[model samples]
Target: MEDEILGKAYDGRLMRRLLAYLRPYRGQAIVALVATIAASALALVQPYLMKVAIDRYIAQGDLAGLNTIAVLFLLVLVGSLAFEYVQTFIMQMIGQRIMFDMRMQIYGHLQRLDLRFYDRNPVGRLMTRVTTDVDVLNDLFTSGVIAVFDDVFTLAGIMVVLLVMNWKLALVSFSVLPLIVLVTQWFRRNVRDSYRTVRVWIARINAYLQENISGMSTVQLFRREAQNYARFDEIDRGHRDANVASIFYYAVFYPAIEVVGALAASLIIWYGGGRVIQGALTLGSLVAFIQYSSRFYRPISDMSEKFNLLQAAMASSERIFALLDTRVVVENPAAPRQAAGGSGHIVFDHVWFAYRGEDWVLRDVSFEVAPGERVAIVGATGAGKSTIVNLLLRFYDVGRGRILVDGVDIREMELDALRRLFSLVLQDVQLFSGTIASNIRLGNTDITDAQVRSAADAVHAGRFIDRLPQGFDTAVAERGATLSVGQKQLLSFARALAFAPQILVLDEATSSVDTETELLIRDALRVLMGGRTTVAIAHRLSTIQDMDKILVLHKGEVRESGSHQQLLAARGIYYRLYQLQYRDQELRAVARTDAR
Candidate 1:
C-alpha cells in the first residue's frame, strides 16, 4: 500500500492543466462567469439604495420618494436571486460535463494500459481515481473556482463604492482590514496541511475497505474476523483524527472572522457617529459605511471556506494527473507489417520476459507450434507456463528477443490484429452478469443467436444450458457464482468457439472439473481443437497424453520435448512427473478398495 505524495498548496502548473479540460465547455463557463458578476453587482445595489432612501425621503418626509426607493430595492433583490440561481445551475452543468469527460478519458486509458500496470496497482485505488478524485474536481469547478470570482468582485465593488461615498469614513471603517488579512493568511497555511492529511486518510480507508470486503470469505474461513476488525478500527481512527484536525482549524478561523467583523463595526460607529453629529457626514452615509464594511468581511470569510475546498481539490488533481501521465509500456507499431499466413503458426525465438526490471520469469525459453498442431506445456507451479501465454498475447512485451505469429514478428504487427489470432480460456473463467447467450457472444454483436447455440452445442454445454428454466436466456450472476465450476468452463468453451479464432490457448482449463465433467470436456475438446492450433498448459498428465507434442519446462527452461511414451523412455523431467502422478492415483485407488 503506497501513500499519496503531498504537493504544493497552490500549484500553477496543475491549475493550468485543470483549466484545459474546461476549454470544450467555454461557452457555458463564460455564461456562468457573466451571471456571477451580474449577481454580485445586483447585491451591491441594495445598501446604496437604503442610503438614498434615508437621505432623500425618510428625513425630509417625502412619501413618494420613499415608495420609489422601496420598489427599486425590491426589484434589485429579486434580480439578484434570479441571477444567482442561473449562475449556480450553469456552473453545475459545466462541472458535471467536465467530470464525465475526465472519467471517460481515465477509464479508456486504463483499458489500453499493459497488464504490468494492473499487476502493480490495486483496483480500490484506481476506483478512487475514477470516482472520488474526479468528484473532488467537480466541487472545485461548481463551487470553488466560480465562487472565488464572485468574492473578489463583491469585495472590489464595495471598496470602490465606499471610497466614492466618503473616503475619510471609508478609511476609518477599513482600519480592521489588516488584521483580517493576517488571520486569513495564517488560517489558509494551517488548513492546507490539515486538508492534505484528510485526503490521504480517505484514500487509505478506501483501499483497506475494498480489499477486506472483496476477500471477506477468506477472512471468515480463517476465523480472523476480530483481528481484521481491530486493524480496520486502527485505520478508521487515523481518518477520524485527520478530520478532527481540519475541523479545529475551521472552528478557530470562522470565529476569528466574526470577531474581526464586530471590531470593524464598532470602530465605524464610533468614528462615523461623531462625524455625523459634527455635521461633516450625513447619517445615511454613516449607515452605508457600516453596511459596506460588513459586506467586505463576509466575502473574505466565504473565500476562506473556498480556500479549504481548493486545497482538497488540488491534492486530488495531483493524483488524477499522475495516473493520466503514466506512459503505456506496450503500444502498436506506427507502420505495422502484416503476417504472412493466417494459419496461426507461433514461434518464440528465444524469448525473455519479466513483470519488473531485471528479475526474469522467462529466461531464453524457445518453442514453436506449427499450423493446426496441438502442443501442451507441462511445468511446475512457478515454471513460467502462464508467462508464455501472457507474452504471446502481448500482455507484457518481451524484455528480449522476439515472437513470430504466422512468420511476422509480433512487435511489427498491430496489437489488435495479433490478439485476434488466438482465443484464450483461463483457469478462472470470468462470466459477466448477463444471459447465457450474451455471455457466449460477449458484446460482439456479429455473433448471432444461431452461432451462439451452435458453439454451445459443439462444446456440449447446450445440454445443461437447455435444461435451465429460461434455456440460453437464463441470466448469470456476477463471475457466474450461480453456476457450477464445470458449467462455467463449458460456457467459456462456448465463448471461445463462438469467437472462432485460428489458435486456441487453454491455461489449466480442465484442471478443476469432476471426473464425469472431465470426460464431457475431453469429448468437447476434440471438436473444439479440430483443425485449430492449440497450446495447453496442463498439470494433469492424462489430459495431454494424446497431444501432438509435449514441452516439459523446469525452472523457466525446457528440459524435455517428445511424445508421452517417448519422454517416458527418455527418463527426464516428464518421466518423473508421470511417475509421481501415477503413484498418487494408485494409492487413492488402493485406499478406496480397502474402504469397500
Candidate 2:
C-alpha cells in the first residue's frame, strides 16, 4: 500500500506532460510572470525610499524633501499593489482554464475507453482523477510554479540591495543561510512523504464515502450501520492522522525559519549598529539592512510552503498522466466500413471471449440471425448470454473469431456507426437527471419534442408520464429514483424506440416490472420488434414461446437450438427448462394426490 501511495517526488516526464496543458494559456502565463517580476522590483523600492527619507531629508532636517519622499513611498506602495493584483488575477485565470481543459480531456478519454477499463477501476477513483487530483494541479499553477519565480526574484532583489548597502552587514545576515537550508531540507523530506500519505488516505476516504452512500439502503436493511460506521471511522481517522502529520512538519519548519530569521536580524542589528557608531555605515543604511534581511526570510518561508505544493503537484501529475497514458485497447479501424442499414444480418462465427486471461466466458459459440428475425437465447445465470449482446455491441472484442453485420466484420465498422444499428435495453435501466422529454431525446437536438412524445406514447410510458403534474417536462431524479421500476423500464423502451435502430436487443428488460407493467411492455416490445432484427434473453420461457428460433445455452456453448415446440419435443436442455417452469402446476397436483 505504501509503495502504491507514493511515487518519485519529482518526475521530469510527468512535469513535461503537465506543461503541455499550459501551452494554450501561455499568453496569460507570460503576463503573470512579467507582473510578478515588476511586483518584486517595486517591493525593493519602499525600503530604499525609507532609507532616502532618513538620510537625505530627516538627517538634514529638510521638510520639503521629507514630504516629497513620503508621497513617493505611498506611490510605490500603490504600484506594488497593482502589480500584485495583476499577477494574482492572471495566474488564477490560467489555472482555472487549464483545470477546465484537463477535466474535459479526462472525461472525454474515459468515455472513449472500453468497458474493460471501467471493470478494473472503481468509480470513486476516476471521480478523484477529474476533481481532487485536478484541484491539486490548480494550486501548483497558482501558488507553486509562478509564485516560486516571484519568491526567487524578490529574494534576489533584497540580496542585491542589501549587499550594495553594506557588504559586512549583509555577510553577517547571510551567516544563518546554511542553517535555514539544512532545516528546510529536513522539512521537505518528511513533508513529502506525509503529503503522499494524506493524498492516499483522502482517496480511500472518497472511495469509502462513495460506496457507502450508494449502498446506504443495503447497509441499513442489513442493520450494518454500526459496522459501516466503524469502518468509515477507521478511514476518516487515517485521513486526519495523515493531515496532522503533514501539519506537524509545516508547524516545525515555519517556526524554525522564523527563529533563524530573527537570529539573522539580531546579527545585522548588532553588527550594523556598531558600524554606524564607528561611522563605517550610515544610520539609514543600518535600518535598511535590517529591513532587507527580514524581507529575504519571508520569501524563504513562502518558498518552503510552495515546495510542498510542488511535491503534491508532482504526485497528482503522475496519476493524471498515468490515466491519460492508458492504451485504448479497442480502437476504430483506420478505414472503417460504412455498412448499409442493419439488414440485421448478424453472425457470430466460432467466437471466444474472456474478461481476463484465458478464462473464456463464451467459447466456440456460433450463431446467425437474418434480417427481421426474432431469436431468443435461454440460459441459466452466467451462461454467457449477455456476453453475446456485449460482443454484438462491440463493447468487448472477441478473443478469437469475428462477428459480422451485413457480411462485414464489426471491427471494421466505426463504433458509433455500428452501435447505431442496434437498440439495447438491459435488465437494469439507467436514467440521468433531466426532464422526461430530454431523457428520451438524450443529446440529439434533432429529435424534436414531438418525436420524443411519440416514442414515449408508443412505449405506453406516456400514460404515467401524462399523470405527473409536469407531464413530459417533469424532472427525473438521479437514476429515475422518482419513477417506479416499471416506469423507468418504460422510459428505456421509449429511449430505444426514439433511436429507431434496425436491431432491438432485450436482456430480461421486463424482469423487474409488475405483471401489469409487463403486459404493457410486452405490447410495446411486439410493436418495437416488428420488422426489426430482435434478440431476446428471457428467464420466463413463456415470453419467448412465439419467437422464430430459441437457442438453449447451458454454459458457454449452445446445447440446443430450434423453435419452442421443436426444442421441447427434442427432450433436451430446452425441454428440461420448459418442464421445470411450465410443468410446476402439474407436479404440484400430483404431489397433493399422492399425499391423499
Candidate 3:
C-alpha cells in the first residue's frame, strides 16, 4: 500500500498532480495570489521610504517635511499589515477547502474498494490515511505551498531594488551571500532527513495505541497489563527520542544561522561605511543596504524552520495518495453481458475458488437448486461450506467457470441489485448502533412499523424485544453489545424476514442460540421459507433433517445428497454425522439424569 503512494521525495510532477486539485479553486487562488503580490510590494516600500525620509526629511530636517514624511510612512505600514492579514486569511481558507474536498474524494474511494482490501489492510492504517495523511496535506496547503511563493517573491523583489539604488553597496552587502546560501541548503537537508524519521516514529505510536485499544479485553484477561505498558513505553520512548532529535537540530541550527546573519550584518556596516566615507555611497544608501542584508537572511532563517513542516507534509501525502490510488481487484465486468433471465434459480457450474492462490478449497463444484427448493449443506470444519454461500452472493468471483442466478451469470448483473434479491443471516449477527425498527428497516427500507413488528414476532425475537427498555424503539449498542447472542441472532432473523427475498440463506444462524430459542426460530423460518428457495448450513443436524434435500460436502466435493430419510436409508456421510451428534447428546442426557 505504501508503494502505491510514492514517498521518495517530491515526484517532480507534484505541481501538476497537486494543481489538479487546485483547478476548481482557480478564481479564489488567483485572488489570493494577487493579494500576496500586493502584500510583497507594500513590504518593499518601508526600507526605501526610510531611505527617502533619511535623505530629505530627517537629515536636512525641515520640521514640516519630517512630520509629513512620518505620516506617509505610517500609512504605508498600515496598508502593508492589512494586505498581509488578507493574504494569510485567504490562503488558509483555500487550504481548508482543498482538505475538505480531497478528504471526501478519498472517503468515497474507500467505499468503492472491495472487502478483500479490508481483509488485507488494518483499520488503523486505513484511518491514518484518512486522518493523519490529510492533516499533512492541510499543512502543505496553508503554509508549504504559499510560503515558498511568498519567500521567493519577497526575496527577488528586494534583490532587484537593492541593486537599482546602489549596485556597488549591494555587492558589498551580498559578499557573504554565497556562504549563507550554502549553509541554508545544508541545514534544510538535515531538517528534512530528521523530520522523515519523526514521521515514521509517529505512525508507529499511532499503530501501537490502535492495536492495544482494540484488544483491551485480551490484555486484561491475560493479566499482562504491566507487560503491555512496558511495551507501550518502549514505543512511546522511540517516538519521543525522534521528536527530541528533530528539536535539537532546530534549536541548535536556527540560532547558529542567526549568528552568521548578524556577522554578515556587521560586515555590511563596515564595508558600506567605508564606501560612504569615500564619497562613493550616501547615508540613505548605506542604511538601505544594511536593511537589505537583514531582509535577505530573514527568509533564509525562517525557511530553515519551515523546511521541516514541508517534509512532514510530503511524508503524509504519500500515504493518502497510496490509498486513493489503489483499485479494487473485484470490479464489474467490462462490456458486461446482461443477466439473460433469472427466476431466482441458482447454479454453481464447475466453480473453483481459494482465498489465496494455488491451495484450492472448492474444486469444480457443481450444484443446482430449482426455484423454491430447500437444500441444506452439511460439512465439518474447513469443509469450504461458507465459500459456497460467499460465491452465491458474489462476495468473490469464481476462479474458473461461473455461477448463474435465474440462468444468467451473476457477475454480469449490477452487484447491489443482485445481492438485494436474497436475504442472508450468518452466525456472527452483526448489528450497528440503532433502534430495533431501524435495524430491520435496513433489510428493506419500505417496510412499515406493522411489517417490522410482524417480522420480529415471526422470528420469535418479539419474546424478549418488548421487554427491552423501549421495545422496538430500544437502541442497540455497537454490534448489539446490549443484547445477548441469541437475541442478536433472532433480530437478524427478523431483519431477514423483512426483506421477503425470493431466496433465503441461513449459515449457522442457530449455532449460538439455546435449544428452546432455536426451535422457535426454526419453526418461524420454516414458515418464512415456504415459497422461497432456502439453503441452510448448520452445525447441528436436527434442524436440517427435514429439508427437501441435504448435500454432504468433503474435500470440496459433494459426497452425497438426498433427503433425511433417503440419506439415513443410504447409510452414507449424512447418516453417520446424524448418528454421531444425536448419540452423543443421548449419552450426555442419561449421564446428567443418573448424576442427579
Q: Tell me, by lDDT, which candidate is best.
A: 1
Whole-model alpha-carbon lDDT for candidate 3: 0.81
lDDT of each: 0.90, 0.88, 0.81
Sort all candidates by lDDT, best to worst.
1, 2, 3
Q: State in Å the error of residue 43, model 1.
A: 1.2
Tens digits of per-residue lDDT, candidate 3, 258-367, equal 77768777887888788779978778877877777788887777776666666566667656766788986667666565555445688889988888887898988888
For every model shown, the clashing-pair count is: 0, 0, 1
TM-score of every candidate: 0.96, 0.95, 0.93
**lDDT preference between candidates 2 and 3, better one:** 2
Summarize candidate 1's per-residue lDDT along 1-596 as a digit string, tens digits.
34355556678999999999999989889888999999999999988898899988999999999999999999999999999999999999999999999999999999999998899887878988999889989999999888899999999999999999988888887888899999999888888777677777877788778888889999999999999999989989999999999889889988999899889889889988999999998888888888888888989988887877777778889989989999998899989999876999999999888777888888888889999999999999999999999999999899898999999988889999999988999879999999999999999999999999999999999999999999999989888989999999999999999999999999998887899999999888888899999999999999999999999988888888988889999998899999999999999999999999
What are the C-alpha RMSDs, in order, of all predicted structures? 1.7, 2.3, 2.5
**Residue 25 in model 3: shift from native, Å?**
0.6
Q: Considering every candidate listed, which one attains the maximal TM-score?
A: 1
Backbone clashes, candidate 2:
0
Candidate 3 clashing pairs?
Answer: 342-406
